[model samples]
Target: MRFLVQRVSDSSVEINGEVVGQIGKGFMVLIGVCDSDTKEIADKMVRKMLGLRIFEDEQGKTNLSLDTVGGQLLLISQFTLYANCKKGNRPSFIEAGEPGMAEEMYEYIIARCKEQVEVVERGQFGADMKVSLTNDGPFTIILDSEQL
Candidate 1:
């Protein structure tokens, strides 16, 4: 499992011109699942994401967690995060998880996030999603299960 997390002032996801998910003053997260991923890894990601102290506090320090700032969450599934481009011009998704397991883990992540996040919005899994966000501080973090 892997997560690409970006702090955002606002974010939205559109599929076929219809808005599917949106958030404000929160993290815009893209989730990717690998073939070997399990819910345990997903759980670890959820804990790290919400607990990350990246939001600003009154002292203008990046010391507040999402919960402390009452931030929302905009989560999206992105199999392309696992793209392998070492061999050729075209990227290979061979490291991406199978659709069924990936979607399941994706859904599981969403459910867990909903519990900790004040507002949790999610893009449709497997959809051709168009995501837009105003990155806060242009901050981003990438988390991989292998690192845990």
Candidate 2:
């Protein structure tokens, strides 16, 4: 599993021209899954993500976690995070988890996040979503299961 986390002042997702999910002062996380992923890995990733101290404190130090700042969440599934373009112009998604398993993992992640976050929003698992965000500090982080 991989999570591309972007700290945002606000974010929103749209599907079929209808807003599906939106949030403020939180992380816009694009979650990716692979065949080897499990709930345990997802759990670890969630912990690490929520524990990140990228938010600035009163001293202008990046030392505040999501909980401390009372941040929301906008989680979106993105299989293309596993795109492999080493061969040619076309990218291969063979490393991405199968749709059925990936969707299950996505839902599990969302549920876990909702338990801790006051406001948690998510895009449809298999939908073509249009995501918009104002990246706070232009801060971004990538969390990978293998790295954790």
Highest lDDT against the true fold, candidate: 2
Error of 2 at 74 (Å): 0.3
TM-score winner among the candidates? 2
For 7-107, candidate 2 gives per-residue lDDT tens digits of 99999999999999999999999999999999999999999999999999999999999999999999999999999999989999999999999999999
Candidate 2 residues lying further than 4 Å off, grouped into runs, are: none
lDDT of 2: 0.98
CA lDDT, every model vs. true structure: 0.94, 0.98
How many residue pairs clash (N, CA or C atoms closer than 3 angstroms) in each of the candidate models, in the order given? 0, 0
Give the Cα error of residue 20 in candidate 1, in Å: 1.1
lDDT of 1: 0.94
User: How many collisions between residues are there in candidate 1?
Assistant: 0
